[model samples]
Target: MIGDIHGCAKALRSMIQELAPTKEDELIFLGDYVDRGPDSRDVVEQLIDLQSVCKVIPLRGNHEWMLQSVVSRGMDDSMWLRSGGRATVTSYGGSVRKIPEEHMAFFESLLACYQTESEIFVHAMYDPSCEVATQDDELTYWTHLPPSLPAPHHSGKRVFVGHTPQPDGEVLRQSHLVCMDTYCFGGGYLSAMDLETETVLQVDRHGHVRRVPVERFAMLLKGCVHWFRSRDS
Candidate 1:
């Protein structure tokens, strides 16, 4: 699974090359493919092209929701424009109208969440009280993970999400949830994780690559638990 791209095409390109995934690999992107960086246009184009190389599942982020509201529903774009939409417009040659038909279709087709037997993927937080299928848009695409860990989802499947940027370039890992947004557009890394092996690969816009070892569960949980207890006290 991959974290939010946020228009950092350079980092995205670098990470793809580093992964060197084949047709046998399935890539899940936790969206925000546009806005706030140098090349939202190229980022979307690359994602579309990736379909030919692997099975790509893209989720809708709040940024995508905002863009869709403007381009598809013909709503006021002023809010989106102020919130990094201008960068997206500039990436598309200074107008949203220049965004291609195929790209529009891609945006329209993005999923709110995807689930497998043991894992659930969404762009943002999920309601632990509800099933993944029943999650509302606010929970699926807008809400950030709280400072303290949330209750585990009722399904017993691990939940993976992006949207809450980790400025320190670390994956926010807990027993039940993992947040991969490393804030690439803001000079952090673009992060990807291998679920089976628990390996994390991070790439920067300058094409630097790094591998982060997954922390031992006991140690990770111990520290987090301590923090939570202290916060409550």
Candidate 2:
């Protein structure tokens, strides 16, 4: 499972190759596939293509909610204002007003509230008792979070989530729940989790690779854009 891709396909593609998923293995995405990164468009295209080749599971993040708001409510909602939404609009050449309503609808359809099968997964939900089970229940998924995480997560089926970016890529916060956003779109590392073993793997925009122990990623991995600038200077 992976979290909050946020359009970092360069890092994502590298991480996926390293995992070397097999036909039987699944590649589930925790959502937030767009916004705050240069490759939001590319990420959507990749997900579309992956539908044929892999078990690509997508959950809706707040970013996806923003796109929905743009479609259903006309970008008047704050979902598209905060949470790095402006950067995303600017990345699309700063004329968000001109972007077609139909295109926004396409983005909304790709997001989900939760996808579960023995393990509960979402973009940023952890309330074991949450009634937010469907796409319409999406508001709760983003607004509410449990103060305490349930233990022996297999009992809760190991809640995998993203949206909270820790200093590092993955935080083994309570053994069962893993926060894997890793802020890849912010030039942080992209993270992946091996569900069966509960182990983590990661790869950044640079040529670095790591297996779990993702605490140092934010400090160690600078933005690739920064790397490009340094080379030019």
Candidate 3:
């Protein structure tokens, strides 16, 4: 599971080179491939290219949902612009002259959820006990939260998630959730978790690779920085 990139295509490409997974390796993208920064469309193109070489299971992120809304309903561009969508628009060469055909399909093919042998991975929250059937509903796929606050997840059937950015990592063991949205787009590092070995390797935009030990996954999840309302705090 990688963090919420928000359209850092350069960072993503660099991380992919650093990780250097072979054709035998399977990669599960936790979604939100577009929005926030530049190169969302490029990221989609890269995702499409990667589809040919490896098993790329891309999950739908909130930003992806927003893009879908824009594509499906011709919704106002303000929602995405509020959250770095402008940068994404610029990444496709700021092309207002003519809408490209390939770009249309790139936005259209975003998936809702990805299921593994024993795990369920998505862009946002995941509840191990919720019987999350892989399907087409955006509500369930893009924004479903657990009924209760998820507990520290270390269950055998893990659920890898993004969207909720944290400085450290956030783990819900009882809920079987592991949050990887480490704010890479907000000057944090891009992250990647090895499913076979349960190891996590991360790199910043500048190309510093840091590997997380298996034991640390549970502990480092505590580094998440969740800031709420000023008055409430």
Candidate No. with top TM-score: 1
Q: Against the true structure, whose lDDT is highest?
A: 1
Alpha carbon deviation, residue 170, candidate 1 (Å):
0.4
lDDT of 1: 0.90
User: Please, what is the TM-score per model?
Assistant: 0.89, 0.73, 0.75
Which residues of candidate 2, in runs, are more than 4 Å off? 77-79, 96-106, 114-117, 131-140, 144-155, 211-233
Residue 47 in model 3: shift from native, Å? 1.6
Give model 2's TM-score versus the native structure.
0.73
Q: Give the Å error, residue 135, model 3.
A: 9.3
Predictions in order: lDDT: 0.90, 0.66, 0.66
Which residue pairs collide, candidate 1? none
Model 2, residue 59: what's the lDDT? 73
Q: Tens-digit lDDT track for model 2 on 142-229? A: 7434455444432456666787776555554564666777867665678787877766777775526764455555545666668888
Task: Please identify which of the two predictions, 1 or 3, would achieve the higher TM-score against the true structure.
Answer: 1
- What's the CA error at residue 33 for candidate 2, in Å? 1.2
lDDT of 3 at 54: 74
Model 3 vs. true fold: TM: 0.75
Task: Report per-prediction Cα RMSD to one decimal.
Answer: 7.1, 10.2, 9.6
Span of ten consecutive residues with least summed lDDT in model 3: 222-231
